[model samples]
Target: MTTFGSQSDVIAFLSEPSAYGVSDLVKRIDTHAAIIFLAGDRAYKLKRAVRYPYLDFSSAEKRRLVCKAELALNRRTAPDLYLEVCSIGRLDDGSLALGQGSPVDWLIVMRRFAAKDLLDAMAREGRLEPKLLRELADGISRFHELAEIETHHDAVGRVRSVIEGNRVSMAKLPGMPLAACDRARLFTSSLVLLDQLTPLLARRGEAGLVRHCHGDLHLGNICMWQGKPVLFDCLEFDAGLATSDLLYDLAFLLMDLWQRGLRDEASLVFNRYCDRRAETDGLAAMPLFLSMRAAVRAHVEARGSDLQPDVKGRKDKLVTARRYLASAVGFLDRPEPRLLAVGGLSGSGKSTLAARLAPRIGTAPGVRLLRTDMLRKRLAGVDPEAHLPESAYTRETHDAVYAALLEEARKTLDAGWPVIVDAVFDFPATRAQVEALARAVAVPFSGLWLDAPRDLLHARVGTRRGDASDAGPAVVDKQLERDVGFLGDWQCVDARGDAQQTLEHAIAALGSECPIG
Candidate 1:
């Protein structure tokens, strides 16, 4: 190993990185994160002493902790790729040999795979498969489900802190594009939106989507190991940053694909995720998150552009800033107009019918379906799959939930987009409240009530899976005690006659005034 003491001495890294394989070094990269060197069939990762606000690997123990976090988190998302964390220290002779010897620094040793096979490379080489995207979604969803979620207060603090910290990144950085300056201004102007998002924190806390995620879930961080997708290099340093709303983490990739002009693939990935994990409270957070991620992208690209030598690279980076800005602005553009509310007692077929009828209505290319189970779970500040105590069903909590549903309905309809609100809307107050949102937006509001005898509703709830809702036979019985059936001049559909037949009726009801042109 060569002895180096200063920044210039680190020049050896550029040549040494490819010392593993010349071909690997010839490909690409320019981040102060880690350097890749191959030893046998394994890749040895050495962290840089860069201490950005969002992460810090500037010290020996800090690097070790971060490396361990990376190993543990990546193992969940890409189990085959992350082998183990190898502590690096000086040996008796004062040289580093990973864990074989001892004592200078810490390095994460990973199994080496072909660099050409990373998801980014595959996309560039026109070799990405549809199945690969689907698998990626599945892996991420499962990983998220298993990851630990922070408590509600910590979750909110972590997220807001990231935003505040990024401001520090903006100020201290030497190179920021003019467009980036404009973007910072735009976001500063939009800070009022934070008030809208602030109230949501309580609801989201209850729903419980705040988990430790693959902090850097971009295309470049994913690869195929043994013919399956493997995610790597997750952030390990900042628990606050990693512990956040799941949709905020997901928006990085979705925004990446959308920014890259790969809308079709983006849609495929998004649809696959929705189909598998099926959480809807994120719908409210996603657009807001998409904007933030795009803003981050603008800053990262613009700041990094300072290292480029050519004028074109500089202009291209500015263009990237514009692209991200446009994406953020697009969220507020004309949203489709229609309200589709799905109601029935728990297990009365509301979800199934709404899921089926959604595609037939809405503004064709897209329609948002907002579900109470997801929103309520998020509001509870707990994972959607975790069971809350029985006391969580207090009347106050139910009222807060309906208030959230009404809020979601208003925001969604105002966006000029068709939406499906999936909740019992059992209370007259709740139904009338949300219907008013549709009327205020001057949009036609439609409601579909899925009905079944109490017996079947009980059966469906007892057999549910991977869902965090508290509705069951007991909840249904309690509702029955309070008269939980449709009472106003609202559309009602029989859900007892087979879910398929019930779905058809709902679909027919929706198609009569399909939102899609």
Candidate 2:
């Protein structure tokens, strides 16, 4: 293998398209640490000869090692994209060649795809469907399940490090957009949140929640490939950056969606992922995690402003950076916790309303939706979509499910997070119990009962697919015969209308009870 004395020689050699056995046309994209050369249908990534406080790729050996790491780590999520690491070398006649001669520098070869297929691009084009969002959440959940748990990494310590790093980075900015008072307030609030969540973070880490995950999980790092959302470009330079609590890893994507005004999509992803992982307890840490993620983006964007060559570009980036900082502060501002119950018979759209309202009910990342159907399924030790035997819905099982919901709600409320209970609540006793539970907790409580005609309920139930509720038309017919106690002070929402209209009616009924818009 040929060795080049300087990085310039290697760059000069790779600039020639003939070395890659492709046409003369070459497209190059440069980042802080790497230069990606796209030729034909393949791309070659070469680590730049650079050294930073967090990373070092100054030497050929270091570059080669990082290139290998990039290839290996990326293959875990995007096997089809990361091809292999090849060598860039000089020939005997002082010419450059790929995969031949003495190895001068390492290049990561990858199969290239269209940039417009990225999730961020889809979101910008308004092509981001709910189905795609759910699929993305599912894919991320599966990856987290299979990710290697890092036993040595302390979750709380990692979060502390991130907070400290953000502080240091923001302090280093030449002209920070935030006022001194605002900066101090945001920092203090963030620290307070971190202090409050230290115990939960430690417990989560001890429970093996700390895993080697996709550190950069924003929409830009994901793309629609092969009709599926494939995650790539993970943080391969530093293991410390990549290893953390799984929820914190997910916060990056959540923060991205929230900042982009995709609030519903962000909430949907959060709930779907939590449902798949059965990780509702982590919701308490979401505000801190999301704030940290936003702070990170803010500082990064602020630093990017300095890197821009033009005044207008720098000003625009500064504006974006300030907005991210504001979002970070907003995340830290906790809202008043309240308990909400949405009750109805099968196919009355109670669950749909719960799902839609949960994200907008309280603080960052929304409320914990405690659905009795899901609790019942969990109690039965069956899949959520699994149909339980008729015996499973007996009075004893029913009471057990309600008890479980109450217990969970208590814990969630005790943790200072809002909760939304979705259940049939057909019996007067059940309704009274929920109201009493909220009173006992001393939180503002609102109960919403959905009403729809029998025929409409039956039609809606008949179309149920892969949902947590096992209720079918037969179940709806039986529920029609049950006596639902007096409405009392609870609000009634017309469920026969479309979902958006129903949501509007629910919000209207909520009025001042719902503080978050």
Candidate 3:
């Protein structure tokens, strides 16, 4: 049995540095549901004894259980950061102490990390590097792969519930800043998208795509730990809220990045995650997922606005909530899907152009980039940057890679997302096959064949390091010897200059079809 105690006493005890036997000052951070005290090298998180519609921590036992649950859940991705759950209770002589006498509340102890190490802080400071983003996406993919699959969820109903909840909350928010018509449109459009995606959601659930996932996978919840991104603060109060389609889980981060004007970073994370997970078919639901995630944020901010201590802080929060509301509406207005193929011999800067162009092509995070080299590596069950043997580059293997690339492009197109297939589509058959996929999918198609001097190509391939492509100078020589078929309808771009110049030419060739921001 647990005994209820005063929260102020617990807070005062945790706020004192001497409580941890440390001389350093203790810092405190608060949220609606919890309070964290940072002392020395550790953080103590205590659940607030409050009851909400979504969760209950009104009892000492409830708080203790939730504290234990949070520790267990977070340890899955951040084992080193989470230590143990500690009980706060009254000691002899009626003094509050940790793990001492009659238990009153519980707290999760965690290793303290620098505030600057948080991804959100890094994003605000323009320190989010591409390498870090890629690694983070890969880490997320691996985590999702190992998450327990959920089979009993009414996946569609769950999503529908979120949509309806957002609608209700947005409409009834205190000092609702949004116009009535705008709120109506947001709900109406989101519900319409939900109706259209109901079947796909159910099918994905049947396919075991739904799973227990980090319910709150935002940048703020991720931090740099031991030179890598570590996910923490997973939603532990409610399993029903935490379980979702993995793509839906990922959309929270993607939407977060996009909302922060980190479109390029968002695109990189999205593409890398797709490369790692191959969740291309779920792209159709992305608009809905992204919208719902933003809607959730909007309402959360709106509700949090009321808790602000000052008028200016309250107004600032409402302003942010409305901005998120607008973004939520925009996410649902997905553009028409398109297919683009970037083909060249090794060192023609085809991959470079594809990457630069993808973020600006369509929608928030842009196109799914499919590179044959990466595909080949994936086929061999190796990391994307791992080098392969010459045997892996056989004609049969090349054909198989092209086949797989086209199939993936087709699927991504069917999912109503733009795709850019990067490959050496030199042979007529390979070129025609990719072009045929666009026609089959009824999406606009464009092909850019990069033409660079043989010397430049040789120089490019010779100096390559940590690249997925195994092509060297010898491979470049062989490619130069083979006569590339007529350019046909594919636009030719001069790649002799630097990558930017080549991208400029390709974008010019793409013209109105490829919308650049």
Candidate 4:
């Protein structure tokens, strides 16, 4: 039986165009554990013959099993990308061949996609659009819904192990980029937060929030394929590492986006995902989740520095590692969250102002928005854009919708995330309800009342299409006839002008009360 001497020989074989039965050039992409060779329309991923504390692929049989596992697991999300696991054997002439000779190694075949389609590349080029992020969030939420829940898994123990692993990995790095004091503080603060959240974490595990997730969820592992974002390259070698709380899995992507200076995009994704899943109660764990995700990247970058061939590349990676380390500390110690409410008649630009201000309200991804229109749709079990009958607008339904909004806002605020409530609040009771909630939660609250000409309101709502709001000119007329009780402490902002002007006016009025950037 012909056997390859080392992984280098296998890499060399795969690096040639003849290996892929194509005349085109072959390109190689290397990572710590796998080498991917791209030729023509196909890509082959070969696992390295290396043994690490967390993973072992030292034997050919082990590599084969891992390759099969990867293909099976990744096909869950990226079915079009993962093809099959092929055996690499030898020919009669002692030459290497695929699926023909005595097995020496194995490779996972995948469909090659354009590098520019990678979400990381799109972010670097400022090509990540709002529509794309919304769709991506929807897809992620659906994926989490389908993930297998591990009822018997110890969620606390798993997180503690990760924290300990991070500690050991970072401490062992030669010439560690982080200060010893800072590293110790990060770990201590993370542990304290974990202790505080143990009960809630245990409840979430019991409620089946912990599942087998896409362990390595980040921009680099996602790509735009067939006009949508597809998640691939999941952590397959270790099932324990791949299984965790669904929110923790999502926190990796949120941390990645925030660290890339895409705060608005990050906030949009967060709000969209929460709207789909009603995951507001879990917001309390975001700080710890975000911090741990950042810490994971910090050590990973530091470890990558050791593999850099050049001094400059190694130094750059170390610098990046230090930056990520600092971010980890920052995420764990964010400022207190505030509660902002926008009240106005239908079509008075409250929704626009709330969306614009959300990213600047509090921490990295900003706040959760609780809009009456969206809540009504969610309560009715319909899509946000679906039209509702007039019966859905009864006084009882209105009261129910407002009650749901206030409850969600209270839950989100108590979870240490800022909130923006968008509703008419045309009655004294509804207005008092939200204000009382802020007082009960002991959070800083600011309410903005939008004022606009009746004609302007009519014109705005008349042109609406495919919006979550179902307000029309007739609805605006009804709101105008209704007496919205005295404004009290709420500030009035002029919405007669364009959306930007209204946003600026609202921000100016909130300057003293809200800590918006």
lDDT of each: 0.67, 0.84, 0.88, 0.88
Error of 4 at 403 (Å): 0.7
Instruction: Put down candidate 3 lDDT per residue, 444-514, tens digits, no spaces.
Output: 88889999998899888888876788899888888888888787889999999998899899989988876
Pull out the clashing pairs in model 3.
none
lDDT at position 164, candidate 1: 65
* TM per candidate: 0.63, 0.91, 0.95, 0.95
lDDT tens readout by residue for model 4, 1-517: 1122476667778888988799988998877677889989998999888765467888999999999899999999999999999998877888888887888899999999999999999999999987789889989999999999997989888888888878887887767666798799989999999999898888899999999999999999999999999999999999999999998999999999999999888888988889989987788888888999999899888877767889998999888988999999898865576778899998899998888888887776678888899899999999878999888999999999999998898888777788999999889888999899999999988889999999889989999876789989988999889899898999999999888898889989988778677
> What C-alpha lDDT, on a 0 to 100 scale, does residue 310 get in candidate 1?
96
If the candidates were sorted by their TM-score against the true structure, best first, what order would they fall in?
A: 3, 4, 2, 1
Clash pairs, model 4 backbone: none
Backbone clashes in model 4: 0
Number of clashing residue pairs in every model? 28, 5, 0, 0
**Model 2, which residues run further than 4 Å from truth?**
1-16, 174-182, 306-309, 376-397
lDDT ranking from best candidate downward: 4, 3, 2, 1
| lDDT for each residue of candidate 1 in 1-517, tens digit (9 for 90 to 100) | 1222343323253335443444544233455466665655777777766665556666667778888877877777667777877765446864334465554566666777887978888888877766688778878887778878766455556556666665565555554443556556646644545556665655676677777778778888888878888777776777667777887788788777766666556655664565456544455455556666776665576665654679898778767766766676554333456787788888888876665555445322245667777667768777656688889888898888778777766765554557778888788878877788788889887777777898898999999876657777888898777765455756778888777899767666656555432
510, model 1: CA deviation in Å? 14
How many times do residue backbones clash in model 1?
A: 28
**Local error of candidate 4 at residue 156 (angstroms):** 1.1
